[model samples]
Target chain A: MTLLESRSRTSRSSHGGTAEDSRPGDLCLVVMETPNAPHSEAQAAVSDPPADLSHRLSVLLESIGRGDQAAFAEFYQLTSRRVFGMARRVLIDPELSEDTTQEVFLQVWQNASKFDPKAGSPLSWLMTISHRRAVDRVRSSQSSTDREAKYGASTQDIDHDSVADQVGSRLEAEAVVRCLETLTETQQESVRLAYYGGLTYREVAERLNAAVPTIKSRIRDGLIRLKTCLGVS
Target chain B: MTETNSGRNGRSGSFGDTVAVDLASGRAVDLAELYALDALTDEERQAIEQYMSAAPAAERTEFFDRVRQARETLARTFRIEEQPPADLFDRIVAQLPVQGSGPDAGTPAPPASGHIAGGQFAPRQPASGQPAGAQPAGGDELAQARQRREERRRPGGTRRWLAGVAAAAAIALGGVGVGSYVADQNDPMNQVVRAGDLREASVDVAGGGTATLLISSSEDAAVVKMNGVPAPPAGKVYQMWLIPKDGSAPVSQGLMDEEALSKPAVVEGISSAAALGITVEPAGGSQSPTLPTVAAAPLGA
Candidate 1:
């Protein structure tokens, strides 16, 4: 893939359909004779999200603790890109990522109080939220591929060193990577396949032809080593 | 058995080893790993989440330091790799109304006490009105709200959440109805089983050990597609039929599309088709296949 810094301040309108035009209102279009749908279409109308965004989201999320909206919109702007990126990375569909971003934002709006700054930074918390949702989407969207295959891509394609790079262009990033370098080859390999690639510990086991316990141990040891490398006690 | 950990009263189970305070110092394992990868099991993840929730303030900053490192590294990958669609944020920010835009969304003028309790900003009142929010409800409010909900509904009533979902679904569907056709809208199961969520129904075809049916549609015809190795070949093609679970006469849904015989499709009349089956028939498709071989997966969410 070409290297393009994702510095989008705002480009959702370019997706073509304007907010007024994007009402998911018409179910007759998205669903057809599919059975067991609620006998009526009335049950299909999800609440429409409002259309306006120009504030910093961190501010909005802060207000959300007090049940604020402007704060939410601002939070949306600041975080939507990261949220969408995280979802798309996992789900592999821009449209799905967009939808997932919306869902996560709505969730953030509703659960703002749950955000505890003392726990982690707002961005980190948001990343966790998006990550969890994306994982769910990939799991729920399984088609002909068996669950095992569905989960396989998440593992084999992880780009580890870059995660450190994304956080900031600081020495801390280098330090984390440096620590990663300290692990035994097997331990490091296991960690890369699992985290960045999104593979389950079991799939890693099958791919490596090693027993599950060994894989688990390698993961635990790899993480411990990583923790030490990052200078965590 | 996995060890059962009943965390202080009714809290969810946690996964990581509990760190004794002195041992919990930040120099060992990095905190960023908790959110960095998809490798952790659901249980392990939930554990990390719970721990994060309860983690002390000092520990959290150390964790974010690791997350920032991960972000720095993650940033290097891309053609908008993890970039948001341009201006998506600006558009979202623009739509927010001016009032109620602050930390409290500019706090809606608190309503009368009764309505206040129900107000979106009403202080969450636990039990007999222990004010859920001190400014906004505090942790006590959350606990009290849960406690009150438990008292009113029952402890950990998974049903309340489901009921709330059902009620919300009804109100939403009611608003969209052609007139107030709120027939089965009250039915919880109806609320849960959406057409999009419908799972396919299936039965075995002759020598074919297993066949999965992919059911889809147009306003006109219900398309039924089957995928299976198939049983011993009869002289003719296998015909498809709809056997309604309600025990109605078998409706001739239609012949399977030849392309669909290998893949999935746009079928008609499927919502009404209760159970699906396949039978050996003349290439044109029999009014009813000789025998419904395998019943296909159920359709309708």
Candidate 2:
């Protein structure tokens, strides 16, 4: 898969159909029937998101918390691509990811008021929901025995380096890549196996032919290094 | 042999031994990182969540932030795979329970008092009253507000949250409609099923089973619970309709939840609904009830 950095700084008038053009009730008729049709005919009805995206997203979410349908639509437009992208990676199936994406947005609409800025960034909050839903879809559709059988065979010849190299080149920030590069190769491998491959540590250990305890420490220690390097605080 | 082998190289002896140490540490900082990376086993993940339930809000938020930060940084490594299908956004908005339409319609303002008794874990009352997973409600305005503030903080299925909200609604509205008499407080459907104001009737379905129609004392709401209702054939669903006494077209309340097949669903906003009707419609449900009504329970009967 090709890697493309997300550097959207301004809201472009790309997606069409303005909020004023259609009331929610009339638009809902189209939605309930077609279900898969594009809901927003226009771009999200907001000025360009300021350089500080977290504040803008939080502002939009606050409006959504008050039952503002237009703002909810806008929030979906801003975040749905990344949300869908995460679901796609986790599930590795377009159809399942689509359904999962739909479920995540629905939850967001119903529970937007529940978002606490103090907890984390809006993207993280949103992606957390997306990842959970995607993982759920993945687990529910495939049995554990099937997953283990598949992973055991496929992961043996998997070239994880190629995956990371492709991802690293397109990352928006060189600093993130630089921080990741600081880890020892084994540390990098273990972290990549768990994070991108969506494998548990036990599964990761099995793939790497390492002890579980060794894998655990490698992952934890590597993360600490990355956190310090990235200045996460 | 399996236990001994795994224990020989496992992180802290056996899995059980590891859990003891993990919990004794008093925080799941390591586990949260693993969780964000999708690295924890199912058992380890659940244990961490339970541990998180007991942690302080600041700690929980910090843990969540760390996890999210890791995820965001890691995410920069990949690209968008594909756009979601069209009109998906509209369907999402349409499904949200219409805001400002219920009893709390005019009360969109924040609560007046800022008091809620804070607690480490927000209680979740499961459907069955067995108290198997039910936690005590963190009573007080501050706790309640905090609970509302972070409703999406944890990841219990939203269906459970919906049931809890429905029960809370039943409790709050129960006092307003019936001043003197009280509905059974245990039933989540009590708001629409007070004893004094109840108008009940039952009809036997052609295929078998029974549909019970219950109107609240104020006649503004209803609850329809079905028992042993045969599942609709493939590609079809069992739908419920609220037929008005004023000659309006039957209104659909969407498909009935399978779990609620036995548990009654509170059907609100039914001021002049004359009768309840059940039908078999296409999978997503029809705009109106179709064909011979499988069963009908007249409100006046």
Candidate 3:
């Protein structure tokens, strides 16, 4: 489905399409395929970026930590819309989302130096912060039900093809979805519990009644399968 | 970290240690690297960090590759589009106080001085200088000029020429020494009589809450009127230290309390400190600080 349709659905659920309809921007879709979309695997045949996107983010963060305002602006220009979207997804109010955006940026300014590339990807770092901040806001404002409803609805359309279609066009998330499909039913379920459900590996293991090591290995194997199947560099 | 040469594998009965020989489909797969990249629980992450940190030297290469590949895929999987808010950098810099201020504030270059609080800075004898007297006039003179310029800038160039004059004087008298270095060395008004060595110190509280330390040396042991830190709490005072950063234990200079000296209290051993620190300690200062948050006034910062 297009981003427009998703926003329309979100609009139906809460703010009634007001914010969605008002924006004159391109409804800018990165437009990769959804995991369930037709012809999902075909997008993987075309290779695009040679390096992982995290490295680029790491460099941007390093310059930002050095107090480079121009770099900070550029980082924001590229990242703000997505962050705003995620914030809006979790926090229904535009004003609150904007406030979260401001706080997220302030955090970025304060903690940029802590972004060590060795630990993990910039996306994870940013997402973790965004999610935590969003969660904090939800809890603080006593708006858990409203926030979760919007979150649950928007994420309902999680297709294997969409990641490919949205973030990058070249080699879609087809391989990841396909590799994920190849896992044993239990392993696949475990991977899902950990990934989409945001459960830790230990929690995944506990829920599956499997040993922690098994859960760990299963998730890792699942990802490796996705990496190889997707032909991701 | 203190675990055995090899981890005492506790998974004997654990699922990981089970011997399930897949005879029918005899293919073994290793997934340690893959699991780490997936953001496992803290325990799992700790296990991996231990395994990787202590992995046999030979296995490191393969391990790193798997880790890197996993990180790449995951990095690509999620992306963040967040940016810093406006003018944050300016605010961060603004929060940082200026390097020099307070009583011991005029010396050029940073020298060994008893550590004082409230970011009071001591001037070091310029690499080339006539000691005890270097035209103290230039020191505060330049400071006042700087303030005037700053004041002028405050109104957004309201007093443009005055600010300009101050700026010009600052440029002329900075460490670059546009004027004669020796010209003011002999002037008594410019020289602080080396009181030899400070005997003791006391925190002298002032009207505006700024606490000054009166440090008296022996006869003529450079009496340094270290000032500027506002008086700390009564129950908890700012304890002084002649902190040596050479990795050695600290030496106590003195504590700043209300009952201390009202004027510049003399302190012995005031000139050998590599760095000075003020920590909030018990009423009667402790051997070590209870809270030593160095409000660092960097030497020459």
Candidate 4:
């Protein structure tokens, strides 16, 4: 189904139609078929950008801000999978993740005019929104359930969640893991429990048998350390 | 003031001193980063958010960037490969408020109801170091500028704006500076502060100081003044709430900064509130007041 859409889209665009007329559905169909297409190919058919993928995304976002539907479609085609994948990992429920992704993109469509290139890279901006929305869904739903129900009795389980193994070996992901490895063991645990486990500092402290203040400081310090390691200015 | 002296303070030697001052000031400079990563408790988040709403743009920006970077780093660690339902993209596009289309082509341009389209506040680097409030250009430029500012006002836009404003406000926040930045003349806040026929209500703070609610004669807006209230302790911030006369949920008015203790903060959208309530909360303002009201005043009285 996607292939037919892509072929029709390619032919349509090639035959005097503006590239902007092609839907993202068509773009992704083509993108998914490209292997070794560089870890960061935001636009296919365009020459591969050398380490300037962030720059391309920023430009595309700027165009989207101007009410360019084509730019938005291109963005959606390139990024929806990664966005959905992030939602899935955090929400841990496929159905909920789908809903969150839908909402996230809806927000993107409604709020694309709000993207500021100077703030950060386009991917980070979108991911930040994706993370926040997914977490909100998790927290609101978790409010009705027992908080202590998810993590078992021992703190040892904090380190053993299979979620960590599921991380892809993309260069950026590898770099993150490398930077994460630089933290002290306790800092690593605190960050993981808070970020991946989606537990608040108080809960992380409870799981680690430490004070809440201590957990807060650990997470803060750990993040600062991670920032420096990641070379984020 | 010499390079040698500056270097020493820049080193880890002065790190302890800096931490002590931040703590003594009751500022959660550290927790601001944690709050961004969703690592803090509700109370902590509220406190930090309150601090941030009034914090210097440089500080807020630094923290926001750190948080964004932290999130981006953590995001890379997610190894899943799930795709959203196929129709999701189409659904999003279908719902978009179509732009530039005729009456039948797309959704009519959202009523230019002056409602901020929001999510636009990606802080631009202000070349003149002017307050962000003053430079909102009129007409098309104004619309673009308003959209930018409104972005920060949107959910999820706060963190994003905090980062943008950091860059935009880097010099501007300093020009407006402590105790006066929020008072930038262009903000609606100024109208309430200078409102004619104002009324007043006061409540004593249990921690220390007094909080006064200054309502405009028309009761459309309010300016809150805090006196002698010490900086909030770690993991906590002072949040203001508006309780409707009809017993509806309290509407959050935003975090009250430490500076507001020494000055006045105009609470937007509170003229109709039956009473005004202040509570200690975790950094970002709460969904509802989490702690008992530390201070309360009847607005109608």
Give the per-residue lDDT of model 4 (tens digit) for A136-209.
Answer: 77787775133344423324322212223221223344566788787788887877666656677667777888
Ranked by DockQ from best down, the candidates are 4, 2, 1, 3
Candidate 3's displacement at residue A181, Å, is 4.4
Q: How far in Å is the alpha carbon of B284 misplaced in model 4?
A: 62
TM accuracy, model 3: 0.37
Tell me the TM-score of candidate 4's A chain: 0.68
DockQ of 2: 0.13
lDDT of 3 by residue, A1-233 (tens): 64434323322221111111211111122223345533432232223232323455576688667554334433453455456545655565555666776678778866888898766567656765665566456546744344335545646733212224332432434445555566567656655554434455555665667777566556655666656765554
lDDT of 1 by residue, B75-163 (tens): 22111223343223333333333332334332332222211112243321223343321111233342234334433643322222221
lDDT of each: 0.42, 0.52, 0.41, 0.53
Candidate 1 local lDDT, A100-163, one digit each (tens): 7776876786677777655544665677667667766765674314434533654453322222
State the lDDT at B12 in candidate 3: 22
Task: Name the candidate that leads on lDDT.
Answer: 4
The TM-scores that each candidate's chain B achieves against the reference are 0.29, 0.37, 0.27, 0.38
Q: Is candidate 3 or candidate 4 better by DockQ?
A: 4
Task: For candidate 3, write residues B99-126 as lDDT tens digits.
Answer: 2334322111121222223332222222
Estimate the TM-score for candidate 2: 0.47
For lDDT, candidate 1 versus 3, the one ahead is 1
Instruction: Write the residue-wise lDDT of candidate 2 on B188-210 in tens digits.
Output: 35545433344443345546455
Cα lDDT of model 2 by residue, A88-173, tens digit: 55665656777888899888877889998876667767877777777667777875455555444544623212212222122323
Score residue B200 of candidate 4 by CA lDDT.
42
